[model samples]
Target: MVSPERHAALQQAWARLLDGYRVTAAAAYPVFDLLASAYSAPDRHYHNLEHLAEMFRVAARLTAITDDPAPVQLAIWFHDAVYDPRAADNEERSAELAATLLGPLGVPRDALDRVGRLIRATAHLTDDRPPPDRDTMILLDADLAILGAAPERYARYAGAIRAEYAWVPEAEYRAGRAAVLKRFLARPRLFWTDLAHQEGDVPARANLTAELAGLRGGEPAA
Candidate 1:
């Protein structure tokens, strides 16, 4: 969870972003409250406002590289907006929620489409991928940044993800989680952006390797 001051700062940041789109504070505050409520839901062990804040930091670092940063920022706000630990279509539903909410809030159709694609890209599936887009690359990199976090934080992330899937039996959860991690590990690269690649690539691989071992009830890979 974020500190009270940081949470206030995040609110101010959201207000400012909405103001840029010419959304009046009256209209913006309600939407902000809705998003806050969705993210702060009791079922969430991860994928909350804190997660958004962390991705915001990564977006800041990536702003210089993307042709357009606004849609990327919008995606960050709404990507996990409809997370359901048991659902296969969280990304699709989140994109729909974003369109349902953002359309009347002044986001243009084209930008909304771009934002939807960016949000969907978080599924980490390469098949049926969005067109080659720098913004998509940046957003995907930011979403996976937690993978490269220091060991303790990475362990916490793993535990929290498991908590989010707490209903799953240990044996089944381990198999499913291992498959996801293995797919990432099999890839030639973990992060697409040069900045994220430099900062996260090696460590992300190591962390994924370690977590895969722990999932199998063994020590993290050396």
Candidate 2:
């Protein structure tokens, strides 16, 4: 959950970023408001304010190492903006929303395009091209950092995710979740950054793998 203090901190962080950029408070507020409204669905579970805060925290740390921050921040805001579990093209929709919202903010056409591309990048577990610059890599890592969280946190996240799909039948939910878990398990690197790779990836994978195994009526592996 995002504490009031944390939410305030995120707003301050955004304010600071805005100060450094050519944009105005007017433009930034609408972007933030629109993103918040988009994620405020009544059925939302894991994709909510808390998730946004966590990504922003990671993005702050990553900003120090990246040349471009605007595109990265835009990506973070819109990556899960349209998180309908049953939708096959949520990423595309989310990216489209980001482009639509940011285009009128006087954002350079190239920067807006990069943000759209970064939003779409989150849909896949693997990317053939080298990560899209430093900022994109950071946004990508932040979005996926949940996979490497502590066991209990990962378990909670998994449960929340499953709850989001409560519309699905039990058997279908189990199968769908198992497939997603297996896909992550097959990945060579779940965390792309050295910091997250060292601290978060193993525990996240272990937690999910164990949970999936137990869900399948076997003993937990972790």
Candidate 3:
């Protein structure tokens, strides 16, 4: 759970971004409310507000290390807005809603389009070229940062994710989830940002490897 202090900090971060962009507080509040509604689903566990808050915290930390933050923040809001456990097009749907929402916020059309693209890049299965912008990489990295959390936290996240797909049979869920874990393990770098690469990449890989090994009924890798 995100602490009250952290939630306040996230609100402050959002306010600062809005102030910097000259966006009206009126406009910003509604946008956030709409995003909250969009992401609300009783069946979703890790993809719920807790996940959003964590990504926001990670995005704020990462924004300090990067040049632009507008697109990154926007991406965070829309990345999992349309999470559907049984659907494969959640990314695309979320991206579309992002573009529609941001387009009217006086945000530039180009920027809105870029935000849409960034949201789409969060798809778990994709063979497209790498992310097109720094913001996309930051957004992606923040979403995956949980993979590097302490073992207990990682285990909690795994359980939460499994709960989200509880409707699926255990055997099928195991196969699908194992594939996802392998894809991340196969990556040369789990985190795209230099800071996260140095701080989170190794631990994330180790955590995933150990977790996957345990899932496969073997002793966890040390």
Candidate 4:
């Protein structure tokens, strides 16, 4: 569970974002509650409120790049709000959930559209979609910032991810998880933004290589 101060900070961030669009406190509390409950579910390990807090910390570094950070911030909030390890459409559904809930709260249409698109981009799928714009790249970078966290923190992240997939057998989980890590390693660049690249790429590659070795050599996961 999060500390009272941490919870209040998260709520305050949400309130500040919505207030720019003229959303009142009364109308905003319910949506915040919904997100809190969703992220706090027992099944979530890596994709929980802690991850949101981590992303928020990363977002703090690069706010100046975007003309309007509201939609980018919105995408960060809802990107994994619907995560289910077994589901293939988590990003799609999360985007829809953002639209459905925020539409009624009066986020502008263009902003809502950009938020939806930003959330979907987090999938990192290799479809033929056009390249992401700058703000979308910022959202994507923040979403993936955990990859380059300190070695100890990355180990905890790996362990938490393993915990989330505990339903699968150990062998199956290792194979699947290894494949995902390898895919990241295979990418031309793990992070898109210059600051993110500088901050995370080398460490992320090292983390992935080490984790892959652990998985392949029968070392304990995380």
Candidate 5:
């Protein structure tokens, strides 16, 4: 559960973003409640309200790069709002949820579409995924900022993710995780933005490499 202070701060951030888009407080509260419920769902481990809070903290450092930062903020709130480790269409489903929820709250169709695309971009499936626009890149970078976290925090993030997928068999999880790590390592740049690269690339790479080695060495899964 998020602390009262953290929850208040998140509420303020949500209000600020909504006010920027001309959404009224009356409309925003119910929407915030819906989002809070989604992120606080029992099955969520790493992709919870805490992760959203962390992304907001990261987003604050680099808001200037985006053409319009508000939609990116909205995308951050909804990107993993529907996360289910066993589901293949989590991103799409999350995007649709954003559209369904945000459309009537006075968010424009263009903004909704942008948010959907930004959320979908978090899939990290392949190297050939669509090249991100400035705002999309900002949202994507914030979503991945955990990889660049301090060592202890990064380990916690790794463990949380493992917990989320605890249903998978140990060997199968290790193989899948190794493949994901290899894909990140193979990327010419793990983070597209200079700020993100400087802030997270080295530590993220080190974390990935160490975790990959552990997987290969038969270390028990978290």
Candidate 6:
């Protein structure tokens, strides 16, 4: 459960994000409730309120750099709002949910479209194209900030993700996860924005390389 203080903070943040669209608080709480409930799903381990809060923390430092931060903030709130590890359309579903909920709150049609696109972009590794704009880059980088977490935190994040896919056999899970990490390593750049690369690239690469090595029963290179 989200702490009372944290919940209040989230509420304040929601109100501020909504204000950018001139959305009244009266019409926004229900949508906030929907997103909160989704993130609180029992199946969610890493994609819970903690992750949401972390994204906000990352956004707090990044909003100033984004071309338009409001939609980026909104996108962060809804990016993983419909996560289901077994589902291929999680991003699409999350974007759809955001569009449906925010439309009634008076978010402009163009802004809504942007929010939807931002949420969908969190399906990051699934696509090869780079982030299309500064706002998209900020949103994607904020969502991926976890990759550069300290070793202990990164290990926990990996463990949480493994737990989420516990139904898969260890060997299959390792193979699939290794493939995902390798794909990222093969990329010319793992992060789009200069801010993200400066803050996260080295640590993120180290984490991925270490995890991949562990998955393959080998030591990470010196």
Residue-wise C-alpha lDDT for candidate 5, range 54-146, written one tens digit per residue: 998888787888667888899899998888898899999999999998888888999999889888888876444535477766777788898
TM-score of each: 0.94, 0.88, 0.86, 0.96, 0.95, 0.92
lDDT of 6 by residue, 98-154 (tens): 888888777888988988988888988544577778888788777889889999989
Which of 1 and 2 is ahead in TM-score? Answer: 1
- Give lDDT: candidate 6, residue 21: 81
Regions of model 6 farther than 4 Å from truth: 125-128, 218-222
* lDDT (Cα) of model 6: 0.84
Model 3 misplaced regions, further than 4 Å: 1-12, 124-130, 218-222
Cα lDDT of all candidates, in order? Answer: 0.85, 0.76, 0.78, 0.89, 0.85, 0.84
What is the lDDT for 104 in model 5? Answer: 86
Q: Between candidates 2 and 6, which one is better according to TM-score?
A: 6
Which residue pairs of candidate 4 clash? none
Deviation of model 3 at 151, angstroms: 0.7
Which window of ten consecutive residues has the lowest lDDT sum in model 6? Answer: 213-222
As a TM-score, model 6 comes out at 0.92
32-69 per-residue lDDT for model 2 (tens digits): 76666666667877898789888887777767777778
**Candidate 4 lDDT, 109-201, residue by residue in tens:** 888899999899989885233345878778878888998989999999999999999899999989999999988898888777789989899
> What are the RMSD figures for all models against the true structure?
2.4, 2.7, 3.1, 1.6, 1.5, 2.7
Candidate 1 lDDT over 1-222, as tens digits, reads 778887788788888888878888888888888888888898887888889999999889988986668888889989999999878999999999999998998878998898898899888878234338788888888898999989988888888888898899877888889999998888887888888989998999999998998878744322
Candidate 2: C-alpha RMSD after superposition = 2.7
- In candidate 6, clashing pairs total 0
For every model shown, the clashing-pair count is: 0, 0, 0, 0, 0, 0
What's the best-to-worst order under lDDT? 4, 1, 5, 6, 3, 2
Best by TM-score: 4
Q: TM-score of predicted model 3? A: 0.86
